[model samples]
Target: MKKTAQIFAGIRTPFYYYDMEILENTARQVKELAEKYRIDVHYATKANEDARIVSLLSEVGFGVDCVSGDEVKLALGCGVPVSKIMFAGVGKSDEEIFEAGIAGIGAINVESVQELYIVNAIAAKYGFVANVCVRVNPNIDAHTFRYVTSGLNTNKFGVSESEFPELVEMLAQCNNVKFRGLHFHIASQIKDIAKVTKTLCGVANRAVEWFAGHGFETEIINLGGGLGVNYENPYGDTFPDFEGWFKAIDENIVRKPGMTIHVEPGRALVAQCGDLITKVLFVKETEVKSFVVVDAGMNNLVRPAFYGAFHLIENLSAEERPSLPSNRVYDVVGPVCESSDTFGKGRQLPLTVRGDLMVVHSAGAYGQAMSMRYTLRPIAQVVYSDRINEAEKETPIL
Candidate 1:
């Protein structure tokens, strides 16, 4: 961080700084663990679709898990093989289905029985057989945020257990759609391993057996990724518990012969490697509260305003002033118009002043991907740690 801080000193603020070393280390760890457990790991493209990140993960032997036609095309353009791409979503348009069919990529995870017929019709029109996997609602609470929980019966993400018979009958009729296996995605930011090993795996195992009994052979079991990262302490234990996660699956999941286990991890692979670097614009002191306003707004990073998520905030410039007391508390806010544009309230830090650099840690997952031009704020630019010297030469110091 000290070395990277020097680079940030010269560059403009309100940009995303990616630590390549951290990303590479995390990716290598995930790959090693996945290979050890004989699991097919797919990089969830929705996490951070930066071409460089996607290309790096693809080079590291991770497949791409896409939730849209554009993502599918993006994966293919990034040198990911067609056989390694998986398309999944609840509401896919006819045009998107046609794109996937024409691409002839890997399995399309069918969320509804109706989608199965649509995929079949699209494949038939395109003169190709579409491989599909039934996305089942395991009815297991992921113990995460309500907005991200998908495996519950109340969630509109996957087909419920009661709909399995109809789904099977529909699958039997869709000649252009070949049943590949079952897919289950519980939620995002799931910290409990028991939820996966004790609850999710059991539900999936029984579902696989039930399908087999109905004369439908299961070939792939895609346990969708919701592995959480340490948000409170980004620097400490920067990597997720990939070893424990794979071990749990290895010990608990019951896979049939010739079956493959797949995981679609998004945040776990890229979250820790990124930080939203912004400049402190003003230091406002009211009778009731103190606010450290920044140049970046909710348009730059919305996790705090949107999901009420937490990210470790650090005042980078204050590190150089050792004499300054590090005991002040203030609310860190952005320049956006909305009251919810606040990043962190009651944040403890050193005496932060105007022109100081501040960073929101662990923002690689949905940070840039979910950014918008709301209020016409310009999107943040990206800077890589490996190319800092070049950036220093080109970027004008503010």
Candidate 2:
């Protein structure tokens, strides 16, 4: 913390600080664990998509999982091979489909029947066989937040059982489409490993059997990544339990011969490696409560305002003092006009004053990726540890 504070002193506030060491370590662990089981791992691009991070993951031998056309192209720009990229999104545009077909991406996870037809048409136009995996709605309740759950029957993600038969029939008639396998993504931030693994195993096994009965062989079974991380205690559990996570899948999922397993991990891989550093602008004390207003707002990091998520708040300037030595409760907020732009309701911290730097922990995943120019605020700049340290040692912070 002291080293980071010195390295970033006088540079700028409201910026993202990425510890490259943590990110590389996380990637290494995920890769090592996935390789142990021969499981194919794809770094979900939606997680960070920072060119540097994507290039690092590409170098680490991890494929990328892109959601939209822009992300697909972004991954390509990051030098991820077309064969190492899998595009998955429910509402892909015609241009996106055409581009994916032209690029010959690894697999497009077809979410709906209409998308299937559209993809097939685009592939036919391009004279290329589109490799696609049918995203199945397993109806498994990941028991995660309602907003993030995608595998529920009511969600608009995958095709239902009744719709699957018709989709299979349509696939049989299409000359430009090749059936690769089935895809299942319950949701994001899933904490219950047993519940998710058991449910995924049941759905995948049944789906494989049903497809075989219809004279189809699945080459890949993608268990969409929804693994959760410890946001409340990011330092204690910096990395998600990848060993236990893969163990659950390997022991539960009934694999077919020559079948490949793929998982798209987003949050679990990148969430803990980043922190949002915002400077305290004003310490307002009112009759109602004390509010610490920071220059950063929801436009900078919206997880708190958008999802009511909790990120550990630390006053790096007060690291020398005992934890919350003052024992005073304060509402840490941002400059955004929205009432929901509150980071923590009643955060207990040490005596804080103007210009004190605060680090919002566990922000690497959705932090900058979801940032917007709302309220006409310029988005925060990102400062990487590896680069900033070297430069800071030679000169002053910029």
Candidate 3:
């Protein structure tokens, strides 16, 4: 991990470089802190559920937070037991619900009463009772990426807090479903406490305010993952201030000791630990604009194109990294056809060449998970610790 710059200096490009040491430490940090509060934390599988990544998280005593039936199967396949997995999504198909029922997952964070009914029917058919938590749209803004924002009232995600009483009545009237708790998700990449605290505060109040009466009690409060990472400077604070982050929950949320406060943290735990590596395919110097076309494309990392995201670009070949007024300014583009397929535009970095290798810093989460085969691009591969990637880094052109 420490030699990321030096190691990528000689290796092939267009692949993601994962820092195992950093990732291991991240898992330890999360597990240890979560243990302190005795809170149940499930790492969101949607972040980056590589087999090794999931296994490392499991070793640290984290549960699984999956958004789809496929992710649930991946978690279980990777040895994260169904007993410790939770499924939450707005559009789970009947087939997925039936599969979850048969698997008897730990809990299904149901987005609506209709979903709860479907899950219940599937459970009844499977001769099992499904545990479920209703996802409530807290209507709080996370102030992060608009594309990732999922908890607004306008976002077709969760049930309204106003409908909680009716939902409780319906749940009590049902026989096959076991009510678990209330689930709340504000938005993603939230850095402001005002947003998180307010969302959590709303969740806390609604738990006791909306459903606790009339024999309906809320158990788990699954705050869906959306913790914004330090894209501005990932290494500045390798890990987020857990104390401050948790303090937001502490000062804002009023959780009873008995209630299992669950957090679904995805990027905050892994973003700093990984970097995407790509070799410079060509350095075109046009009078209009300089372009650095890399071997890796939007197919390998789509956050830039899909969400207008930015990943710090690093010139691995530069012995002495950039110190502005950096003479270099290039549009670090990929091989994808669409103009939006670029990663960082007009970014300042050390001068690079066609053979020079580059690094896309802070791509641990939502990086490889979002890769696609668009434009017939072959998927990118990843290499573990720098030491392990040396010999095998010479990947053939795809």
Name the candidate that leads on lDDT.
Answer: 1
lDDT to native, each model = 0.89, 0.88, 0.79
Off by over 4 Å in 1: 1-4, 390-398
Off by over 4 Å in 2: 1-4, 320-324, 389-398
Clashing pairs in 2: none
Model 3, span 1-398: residue lDDT tens: 46445665556556767888898887887777777766688889898978888888887888988899999899888888787899999999988887876788888888987887778777777788888888888777777677778877889998887777677777876677888787777777888845576567666665655677667676787776776788878779778866566656656766765778788888888888878888888999999999999999988888888889878887776645555235689999998889998999998877777677788889988998988898788767777884464535564565
After the best TM-score superposition of candidate 2, give how far the Cα of residue 348 lies from its true spot, in angstroms.
0.5
How accurate locally is residue 55 in candidate 3, as Cα lDDT from 0 to 100?
82
Residue range with the least summed lDDT across 10 consecutive positions in model 2? 389-398
lDDT tens readout by residue for model 1, 204-294: 8999999998889999999999999999998887899988888888888997899999999899999999999988999999999999999
Q: What is the lDDT of candidate 1?
A: 0.89
The alpha-carbon deviation from the true structure for residue 61 of candidate 3, after best TM-score superposition, in angstroms, is 0.6
Candidate 1 Cα RMSD after full superposition onto the native fold (Å):
1.6
Using TM-score as the measure, the top candidate is 1
Q: Residue 366 CA error for candidate 3 (Å)?
A: 0.5
- Could you report the Cα RMSD, in angstroms, for every candidate shown? 1.6, 2.4, 2.5
